[model samples]
Target: MKAVLIEADTISSAWSQLIYEIYKNGEEHKPDYSMSTRRLHATVAINDVDNNQINSFVPFGENLIKKYKEELTEEYAEWYISLPDDDKRKFDYCYAKQLFRYGETAYNTLSENLKNLRVGSRRHVGVLWENEVHIPKFEDQPCWIAYKLELLNETDVLLYILYRSWDAYGGFPANLPAIVEGFKKVFREKKLPYRIESLIATGWDTHIYESDLQAVEKIFKIAQLCPKCGNLTPKHALISTTKGKVCTQCKCRM
Candidate 1:
């Protein structure tokens, strides 16, 4: 499998390029573990973590993005406390639970790591998967596996994330922003002086599922020509609204 590398100034751009590259270059494959998909191995670097919104022609909207981010930043225990015992055990492996509450005591991995960094502990990595917990499961396993924070030159912090698998069409837009929000929450709480320099994400199986092929086609069709500017642009570079579609460059509405 060829590894594709994408470097963009924002998450929106990275996701846009990623989906287009997969649509253009990926090969169709049926994995034993999951649904058939057009798959690629990809590494994406977003230079500005703050510019993480998906202002594109994707299916989902900001509400879904906000929910995903809340799952990362909010405390799982607080939410879990309201759930019945059976319900809690059945839905045990959300990103929130794994991230904010891992292991027997529900150790807060992000908080612990931030605290370590504050006191000058060299460890900045957080593990989201446990072999004992996740290895036996074929379903409900986390696509996201781990994350690391790298402090560079005492000025900026770069976040590196790893995913066992990623759904390029349905998952990428929401996931990236959520991860960045999670880290920003920690940085703010810890009162870290460093800015988030970039976000580097690697996915072993970055893919668009067969079910989403039609939607991908629609996105490409919409991107072919800006209705207002009449210039060719990718869908990610344009913003769609109920009133009209707007070109990012010319800001013309149609």
Candidate 2:
């Protein structure tokens, strides 16, 4: 698998660059349990979490982010308990459910740790997957496995997340901002002085599905990297004609 690293000032740029890199260099992977995809191991670091911008290229918007944020922070134990037994078994896992009401006793990993935060607590982390429960399943498993909050300085904290598998195109846009919002809410409620300095996300099997390839290409058609200079040229700077597209930066024909 190809391993790629991206550092950006905002989430939009990081996600855009990630898609471009995967489109350029990702290898085709066919897993028996899921759909075939163009996959890469991606690690993205966003320097400014507060400046996370939603990309207009994708269909995702603010409403989706808000919904995901609520799902991440809110507890749904009562709803789950009200469901029928068969339905409960069918709906095996939810990220919020696992993080807040995990196991039979409904242990709240995130709130419990935040409630007990000390002056120098730097290892506050949340678990979303239990090995004993999810190891046997090949499908319907959680992509987001865990997250950690580490103190970077006296007034800044870094949010680091890990995913066993991720859908770069569909999931990356909304999921990231929602998680950040959820964390921020808790930190504020706890009266913590630390602000989230940055966010680092690692996706072991980061991929774009085969079905979304054309859509991804369409979104980036107006803007593409120059073949010679390898710099992403703006749409207005590119010269498109009946013959082919030309890069104004390096004058490379595509």
Candidate 3:
């Protein structure tokens, strides 16, 4: 498997670079289904996750983030809270259940682990893929596998994410933010005195589908223009320009 390692100042920047690298150097291949692309195995590291620097490369904006947050963490109040865990393994797999809402959520489990952690402990981890449940079925199985949080010091935590496969265009953008946000919630609720030190994401198969090329090009264009505005463009909006890049509301005034 070919490899690409990207280190960027922000998650959006890292994601953009990953897409561009895959576009340029990814090997062409066919997938199990119709949509295919030049793909590669890669690991991405974002030193900082700017709440404001969400990438224009993503096809949609914060709404996508909201959707993913619910899917991955079920953070919203309107979520299906009463549904029982499937006993027969006959129901289709739901990633959120495996991650945050089954008998014991990954967040719940990790919080317990962190609370009991010692200064030099190595057990801060959460898992989303279970063999008995996922191995029997194929639909809606999780692409994200597991994550680990390592306490580096008294005031910082290092997060490592593992994805069995990732869709660079849509899934990754949503996955990264939702996971980070979920961690923040856990840390805060647990009252752990730790801030995110760094985030490292490893994906086995990361690729852009051929059909999404037009949207990808649009994102690249937006990334190029951000520097003109001091990089303050909102995470996901159909942006326009005045003297420089501005949000649609700002553009409306001009």
| lDDT of candidate 2 at residue 47, scale 0 to 100 | 88
Candidate 1: tens digits of C-alpha lDDT, residues 21-51: 8888998999887679998999998887785
Q: How many residue pairs clash in each candidate?
A: 0, 0, 0
lDDT of 2 by residue, 136-243 (tens): 976778889998877766778788899999999989988888788777887787787768789999999999999999888886777765434333455777676555
Off-target runs (Cα >4 Å) in candidate 3 are 70-81, 84-93, 101-107, 218-254
Output the lDDT of residue 56, model 2. Answer: 58
Clashing pairs in 2: none
lDDT of 3 by residue, 1-254 (tens): 68999887778767767887887788877877558776899898878864544765467888878776666554532143445455453345456555565443334556566777565667878787877777786556678888887878788778888988788877778878887877777678777787888899999989888888676666555544343222324345536554645655445646
Give the C-alpha miss distance for residue 189 in model 1, angstroms: 2.3
Candidate 1 residue runs with Cα over 4 Å from true position: 88-92, 118-123, 224-247, 250-254
User: Model 3: which residue pairs collide?
Assistant: none
Among all candidates shown, the one with the greatest TM-score: 1
Query: Is 1 or 2 the stronger prediction by TM-score?
Result: 1
Would you estimate the TM-scores of all the predictions?
0.83, 0.82, 0.76
Off by over 4 Å in 2: 76-84, 87-92, 115-122, 225-234, 237-254
Predictions in order: lDDT: 0.78, 0.78, 0.70
TM-score attained by model 3: 0.76
Evaluate candidate 2 by giving its C-alpha RMSD to the native, one decimal: 5.9
Better of 2 and 3 by TM-score: 2
